[model samples]
Target: MAAPGTLRRFLATAWLITRKDITVEWRSREIIYTTVFFAASCILVFAFGFVKDGRPIDDVASAILWIAIAFSGTLALGRTFERERYNETLQALMLAPADRPAIYAGKLAGILLLMLAVEAVLVPLVALLFQAPLFRQPVLLVALLGSGTLGYAAVGTLFAAMLVRARSRDVLLPVLLYPITIPVIIAGVRGTAAAMAPDGGEMARAWVSMLVFFDVVFLTLSLWTFEAVMTE
Candidate 1:
């Protein structure tokens, strides 16, 4: 239904937005530093609490990892939007002569990258602290993690952008985000657990498939609705 050249323009616009976000973030390091530090703190606290009971960290490692990402990622998403709002850049973006979907894609990409970086640090720390066999199937774990992260970022970016102009946005962001993202978190934790199991290949595959489905459904929906949501 769209012109052929539309896609190219959309992509170019998206790339520009992504580049701008990354450039600003690289200079300040505020989002990254806060996200990683919060995530690492969560991991350490959980590690200490769980060890008091002499519980096997492996059993709960997957849940802990997802928890770290969910909370830290939420924080990072809020900060990303706030930065744009504070600089009045979001208004500038809205007036630009680019497809709205491109803007959404760029925001999603930026937030997703931040979340993934947080995960990278958290995952290694989780493995080191909990002695999880996370690297046993590094590719599988990464795939599972990526799918879950993508799904979260897709919905999170949409809600965050929509709420950026609202009062109590920080309060509302997690409240709305968590309800929608429960499935992704569940799939991630279960898939990670399955991947860690000796006979979990088949189970992990099933969960990853669900993660993929969630990613596709939410991502497409976000792309479709971003224009209306952002304009409203």
Candidate 2:
């Protein structure tokens, strides 16, 4: 067992990395804006192409929403590590005075925060554009989305680190990430759609539990495997 101070220091290092990533993002504001734009475009395309049949947009709203998130989220993940790779900062991070899991946690936190921010902009935009009832059960929806996003971000961050050294770094993250993330995405969409139903709270709760289970399981697995992945 680690000492209390040792654990605290580890957490502090993780927090520092998380803050650094957010600070860099705040300076540029590029990733959030790009994600929002991509998300908006997805909404517009789906609205034009699929909403013409006078069908309830809610029918496909969940799919549309998650797909937008997944696609745009991939862009954000790819760019997350690009700057470090470009500037050779990753090597410096690897040499920092902290355990490797701390670095992984920080990167995961950063990616998760970015995803949440995009979702913040996305949910309202989606609701307004499609007239979907996303806001009907905000609390449950948020809980479910948060869990699912964290799971996705966990795997995404690890893969980002892995691909940073690859020749096809940009192409590799999603190719490796998306297939693994499908279950989380499905659970998320189902949960969101259930939350939209008249009395879907029960179903939503079940999905939220599933999301939490997925998050915990994968987060632990990712943490344990991160050192190996990063060193390779």
Candidate 3:
């Protein structure tokens, strides 16, 4: 067990790092606005292209929703550490006198917060534009969002560290991330679709379980591997 002081220090460090991320975002607001705009544009394009046949927009709403989210999320995750790389602050953070996991946890928390905020905006916009029944089942929607976003963040955090050093970092993140995140996306979409249905209890439960399992597995893997990835 950690000593009281150790735990306190860890919490303080995590809080400080989280605050730094929020402060940076508050100053620019570029990432959030860009992500929201891209997401909305993607949904609008889908609405125009796919709804021409007079089909109910909800018919393909799930696919469109996830595609927008996945793409926007990739954009945000790629940029998460870009400022640090440009400014050389990541090395400073690594050299700080704190446990590595605290850094990782802080970053994870920040990314998760950003992701949830993006989704909060995107979900309603997509639903409104596509006429999908998004709020019909708030509980399942919450579960799907929670599990899927965590899984995306888990892999994304590590890749953000890795790609920060690469030449094609922006392009590389999605190429690396998409293959790994398919399972989570699949589970999320299925769970969300079922949750939107009146008789979707069992399906929703199963997909949520799969999502939870995926979250636990990838989260552990990301935490364990983050130190090595960051160092390399």
In terms of TM-score, the best-performing candidate is 1
Task: Return the candidate ranking by TM-score, descending.
Answer: 1, 2, 3
lDDT of 1 by residue, 10-76 (tens): 8889989999989999999999999999999999999998765555544799999999999999999
Using lDDT as the yardstick, the better of models 1 and 3 is 1
lDDT (10s digit) by residue, model 3, range 136-189: 889888888888889988888888877788999887888899999999988888
Give the per-residue lDDT of model 2 (tens digit) for 185-226: 999999999999989999999999999999998899999998
Quote each prediction's TM-score. Answer: 0.96, 0.96, 0.93
lDDT of each: 0.92, 0.88, 0.85
After superposition, the stretches of candidate 3 with alpha carbons farther than 4 Å from their true spots are 1-8
Better of 2 and 3 by TM-score: 2
Backbone collisions counted per model: 0, 0, 0
Residues forming the 10-long window of minimal summed lDDT in candidate 1: 50-59
Better of 2 and 3 by lDDT: 2
* lDDT measured at residue 155 in model 2 versus the true structure, 0 to 100: 85
lDDT of 3 at 142: 89
Clashing pairs in 1: none
Give per-model CA RMSD: 1.3, 1.3, 1.7
Candidate 3 root-mean-square deviation in Å: 1.7
